[model samples]
Target chain A: MKAEFAHYKKEELMRMLTIMQTIRTFEEKAGMMYGLRKIGGFCHLYTGQEAVAAGAISSLDLSKDYVVTAYRDHGHALACGMDPKKAMAELFGKVTGCSHGKGGSMHLFDVEHHFFGGNGIVGAQIPVAAGVAFAQQYQGSDGVTLCFFGDGAFHQGAVHETFNLGKIWDLPIVFIIENNQWGMGTNWKKVSAVDDFSVTAGAYGMKGSSCNGLDVLDVRATIEKAVAEARLGRPSLVEARTYRYKGHSMSDPQKYRTREEIDEYRKRDAIQSFRSRLSEEKILSEEEWSALTQRINTQIEEAVAFAEESPEPALSELYTDIYA
Target chain B: MAEMTYREALNRALDEEMARDDRVFLIGEEVGEYDGAYKVSRGLLSKYGPKRVRDTPISELGFTGLGVGAAIAGLRPVVEWMTHNFALLALDQVVNNAAKLRQMSGGQLSVPIVFRGPNGPAEFLAAQHSQALGSYWMHVPGLKVVAPATPADAYGLLKSAIRNDNPVVMLEAELMYAWKGEVSEQEFLVPIGKARIAREGVDVTLITYSKPIRVVEEAADRLAEKGVQAEVIDLRSLRPLDEETIVNSVRKTGRCVVVDEAWPLASPGATIAHLVDSRCFDVLDAPVELVSGEDVPMPYNHTLELAAQPSVEKVIAAVAKVLYREDV
Candidate 1:
């Protein structure tokens, strides 16, 4: 861990920790709000999968690169520099929300930051990501697209089709599979023929690799290399073995897994592991850690307050935006 | 005016649009090396090169979604689906993403794309290959649907579709591709959401579009021989339907008959009938009648295929019924 930290500056490492902590805190607050009937529609949390987003996003050139993901995208949005207030407001279905309240939880878009969107359908964003990469290549820009999907989307036909397009055109894109063990209630083993999703990349004649998603350092290093390869006109697939701490959505009864299994994954919690590593390396002190936690808590509380006070979208808004 | 076939007119439109704008490009199966499956994209590869005239594998969902993504990223992409039948595999992108992006993003993004290809029944192609998909696309809110019945309309409507700032689905008739008509050589564009009055009369209004317009024209000629002067209205654009033209024509004629090659149930023809009944009920002297393709998958047998689709005879019968001239 110390050797890996050598490649990153002290401030960069601290920023990564802050992003992970922010995502964890944000998801916790979102879940509580949903229970209170404040946030409606589908709300998929990114509690345990923070390391993957935080690491891969941190490796990109945020000014030009694009990021697109599936519905479990609150973490990806925040890591890509989306305002926490806008995201929370979007979930609250307010006029000030990122999608102007038209798209509730399943869709969050910020064109200024080049965050394409958080699509609702399974594996639907895969081809769109390829298109974004195609545009980048067409415009003669070196910017790459980070396309994130779940282990469940691995079986979808669109994913394989997109892989072929990316390989044949040599589009600049990194397909990141956040394997959170379960696709809602179904396990990957029951749904997929292969044990590793990245292994399927070989069918498209592209490079494939896997890493520990819980280890932010490992994720960042693997993605950094992949991004470089993509910039050189090559596409690659990376499978990040990870887990999810909460149910798939707010209403999920979670009948498929047991308390023992949840407890086992919690033992390797990403935030705890990173916090301990920072503390042991003397990079962050006890007092500094407490201050950081307090700051994040205040920021989240302010976002909730903003969402609570924002107005509902006007009735006329329904007719507008239907056509450009 | 210059004489050209429907296929030539479409190719000219693509060539003109590609020459007009650098952002506009074509992507689809066989759009490049093979020219086109139906030769609608002939000579585009050599003219624009591979970057602009992209040939894709048989991955409809993948390439279609990619077009949507590219559109959102600030490029105008013209995606050819081979035919509307193959487009079913990519309906998720067209319906969920392309149609809903602007509204979902709250005007922050727009997908200026055109999905064009041959549609409706053609020759012996049955079932999956021969389907009229105008109603399917018109049902989607954010999309604009257009079908041209002549070479002039094909060239004008396609040019407009490529320049429009929204997602447009242009359904071309495979059976009418070789049909020729006089089209103006001067640059022009046919505005979307408008209908054309093909013929003038006073007794009955024959409402139709695309390939069915030809059938209705023949039916109108037959009605003329029977001493019934029939007016003909061509609905070039299905969505944003030209209710004004349809209603006005029906009010003048006092009788209406809609001819469509689509299925009878929950189809575009059904919607038009309902609109006429609701909006021009008092003005109509006779109940509206419809002539539609049989409600079944197109059959391979030539005889069954002929019976499954709406024909000139069917249109004439429907017109006679609407005019209360069953004795004819």
Candidate 2:
């Protein structure tokens, strides 16, 4: 833990904390907006797995590197420093949304930030992420890619194909599995044959590691090596053993897991633990903590206002993007 | 212009495009070391090297999706499926990603890729291999589907497909690859979304594309022997159907017969027949007859397979029905 804290400057750590706080605050407001019937379609919240996105992405050069993630992407999108107003407006199905309201909740894209998308398909984005890495390699760019997927995606064929391709071609990419323990009500332990992805990585001759996901510093420490290896064209896998506090989607009934199990993981909640670390390390005062929370709330309020004021996509847009 | 086989024309087109644009590349199974499954990419590996002329494992979905992603990231990839039959395995990448990305991303992404290889029935490659899958991609809105009937069309259409800023599905015929025709030595691009008047007449309009264009021509010749002048139209582009050319031809000729190597239901021929019936209903002298491959999986036996595909006999019969001349 001392070594982990030494790796990042105070400002960088503070930035990551802000990102985690923003993701938590943004999703909580999004859930409330969903209840008010403002946001429609499937909305998967990133309530519990904030540290994985904040930590793993913090280990990269965000200006040059690319990010592609699964459907539960509000956290990754914010962590990439994409405009929260655009993300909220996308969830609200407005013309000002990231994808102009065409991709709601599940598909946010910012070409400028290199946040490829909030791709909604199951296991579909793996090969695409590999392709993005292929372009960077083809162009001889030093940039590496961060590909995030759920534990459920490991069962897909494309994911296996990508693993083989990653090692064979030595693509500059890190495959991060945000194992939140559930595959849409089905437990990963029940469906997955292996307990850890290290066995799968061994089969493909790729490097693998696991991190204590509740601790943001541990995630950062674990993935930093993986990211360095990726720059040398040696792909690696880093599994963040995290857990979600809420049900899978907005309306999932919590029948699969026990409330005690959910309560157990929440005790080591990422934000709460990080708050303690900041206080213990003398990183910030109690008054500063309150100010940070208040600032995040104000940011969330502005995002909500931007979404509500945004208009619906114009009728002429229906056939516009279909061809280009 | 010089005489060349359909395969040579395609090879020349690929060579020219890869040389023309540094971003253009060829990728598929057996495309590099083995010189392509059908020799269409015969010497591309040697000329373009492994980087531009890539070879991949039999994982169609993986490579195809990679090609789409590469195109989205600003490379023009020509993804070849060994055959359109095997492409069925990668339909998810083609439909869900390639076709939907532009609209789904709300114009932030565009897949400038070309998926090309031999399509439609060829000899006794039976059941799975022998099938015309043009209609599968022609149904997609974001995709541009092209079927080349002549060597010039193959050379020109492929060049255009490689240059177009949209995803194109180029359907080449397996049997016609060795068939020789006049082609330009210099670079040329056949405009997409247009029809060619292969042979002009005033009695009946015989419309077809790809491999079935041969049978349609033979049927037109047979009609001419019986003193019935028949016009033949090769619709090279399937997605953006040239309705004006088709409508004008059928209206002027006052009769129509559509031919295709694919099955009838929901096929390209079915769509064309629908177009003619709806648009040129008042000018038609008879119902638009269709000569399509029998609605069944192609068989292994040579005779049964020939019986299944659009043959000269089938085209002649359909043309005779449209001409209303059973005795003639």
- TM-score of chain B taken alone, every candidate: 0.99, 0.99
lDDT per residue, candidate 1, B1-328, as tens digits? 9999999999999999999999999999999999998899999999999999999999999999999999998899999989999999999999999999888777888999999998899989989999998888999999999988999999999999999999999989788999999999998999999999999999988899899888889888887888989999999999889999999999998999998999999899999999999999999988999899999999999999999988888888887787677855
Q: Which ten residues in a row have the lowest lDDT in candidate 1 chain A?
A: A1-10
Instruction: Compose the digit string of candidate 2's lDDT tens values, residues A33-144.
Output: 9999999878999998999999998888977699988889899999998899999999998999888999888888888888888778888888888888888888888898
Q: Which TM-score value belongs to model 2?
A: 0.98
How many clashes show up per model?
0, 0
* lDDT scores in order: 0.93, 0.89
Worst 10 residues of 2 chain B by lDDT: B319-328
Chain B TM-score against the true chain B, candidate 2: 0.99
- Please provide, for model 1 over A62-156, each residue's C-alpha lDDT reduced to its tens digit, 9 standing for 90 to 100: 78799999889899999998899999999999999999989878888888888888899999999999999999999999999999999999889
DockQ of 2: 0.75
Can you tell me which runs of candidate 1 are displaced by over 4 Å?
none
The per-model DockQ list reads 0.83, 0.75
Interface root mean square deviation of every model, in Å? 0.7, 1.0
